[model samples]
Target: MTGTIENMIVKLTGWLSRHSIDVLRVSLGLVFVAFGTLKYFPGVSPAEALSVATLEKLSLGTVSGYAAQFVIASMEVFIGLTLVTGKLLKTGLVVMTGAMAGFFAPYVLFFTDLFPGAPTLEAQYIFKDIVLAAAAMVIGARALGARLIPAYERQAPVHEIRERVAA
Candidate 1:
C-alpha cells in the first residue's frame, strides 16, 4: 500500500510538472499585462480606483506617465505571450519580476505621502507587486530552457546530442 501511494504521488507530481507551468504562465502573465494596460486606458478596469492625481506625482510628465503605463502594459502582454508559448519563460519571468517592482516603486516612494487618508494603500500596492515578483522568480527558476534557473532539467544542445549518440 505504501509503495502504491508513493507511485501515485510520483505520477501526480509528474503530471503537475508537465502542466502547471503552462497553466500559470498564461493566466498570471495575462492578468499582469491587463493590469499594466488598464493603468493608462482609463475605465479599462474598475472605475476611479486608480486616480490620475495619484499618478501625477511620478513627475515624469503627463505624456510620460501615459507612456510609462502603456509601455509597461505592453511588456506584460509580450511576456505573457512568450510564457504561454513557452519560448522564453525564464527570461520573461525574470524581466517581469524587475518590471513589477519598477512599476510599483513610484507609488511606494513618492505617491504614498500624497494620500494621508489612505495609509494602507501604499503598503497594499507594494506588497501585491512583491508577491507578483516572487511568483515571477519561481517561474524563472523552474521552467525548461532556463540554465540559469537551477531547478530546471537541462538537456544538452543538438551538437552535444549528436556526440552523445555517437558515444
Candidate 2:
C-alpha cells in the first residue's frame, strides 16, 4: 500500500513538474491580455488613472494621458501574445522585465497614495503584481531552458522506471 501511494504521488508530481511552467506562462499571458485590453477603453480599467499618473511621472511629463495608456496597452498585448503563442518568447520575457519595473514604480512615485495609512485598493492591486512577477520569472527561466524535475525521476534514468509518466 505504501509503495502504491508513493507511486501515485510521484506520478502526480511528475505531471505537475512537466506542465506547471507552461500553465503559468499561459495564465500570466491571459492576465496581461485581459488587463491590457481594459486599458484600451477609457474609464474601463481600474488602474487607468494610476497607470497614466505613473507613466507621466516616469516619463517626466513627456508621456501622458491617452498616449501613455496606449503605449502601456500595446506593450502589454505584445508581451501577452508572445508568451501565449510561445513565439518570440525571449523577446517577451525581456519586455516583461521592463514592464514589471514600470508596474512597480508607482510604489516609489506614489507611496502616499498607495499607503494612506492602511493599504488602499490601489495598493492591493499593485501588491498582486508580486505573484505575477514571480510567475513571469518562472516562465522566463523556462524560456531560458530551466526546467522542473521530479526528484524520483532525477534519481535514475526515467526509462528505467516501470511507472508510466505523463508528459
Candidate 3:
C-alpha cells in the first residue's frame, strides 16, 4: 500500500512539474486581463482609487483620473495578451517588470495609507502582489530556459561526481 501511494504521488508530482509553469503563466495572464478590464470601468475595480492616486503621484501630477486609469489598464492588458498567447513573451516580461515596480511603489509612498496602525484592505490587496511577483519570477525563469528538474533527474553522473570528489 505504501509503495502504491508513493507511486501515485510521484505521478501526480511529475504531471505538476511538467505543466505547472504553463498553467501559472496562463492563469496569471487571465488574472491580469480580468483586473485590467475592470479598470476600464469607473468604480468597478477595488484598486482603482489607489491605483489612480499612485499613478498621479508617480507621474508628478501630470497624469491623473481617467487618464491614469487608462494607462494602467492598457499596460496590464498588453501584458496579459502576450502571456496568454505565448508570443512576444520576453517583451511582456520586460513590461511586467516595470509594471511590478510601479505596483510596489505604493508600499514606500503610502505606508501610512496602507498600514494605518494596522493592515487595511488595501494593504491586503497590495500584499497579494507578492505572490503575483513570485509567480511572475518563475514564469520569467521558464521563459529564459530555466526549468524545474524532477528529483530523479537532478542527480549528477557518477563520473562527474567522482571527478568533483577527486578535485
* 1 against 2, candidate with superior TM-score: 2
Candidate 2, residues 10-92, lDDT tens digits: the string is 78887899898888898899899999999999999999999999999999999999999999999999999888889999999
For candidate 1, lDDT tens digit of each residue in 86-125? Answer: 6776677667766665657656555646356764654455
For each candidate, what is the lDDT?
A: 0.58, 0.90, 0.89
Off by over 4 Å in 3: 1-7, 156-167
How high is each candidate's TM-score? 0.61, 0.92, 0.86
| Residue pairs with backbone overlap in model 1 | none
Which whole-number lDDT from 0 to 100 does residue 99 have in model 3?
93
- Candidate rank order under TM-score: 2, 3, 1
> In candidate 2, what residue range of length 10 has the lowest lDDT sum?
158-167
Every candidate's CA RMSD: 7.4, 2.2, 5.8
How many Å off is the CA of 155 in candidate 2?
Answer: 2.5
- Against the correct fold, how does model 2 do in TM-score? 0.92
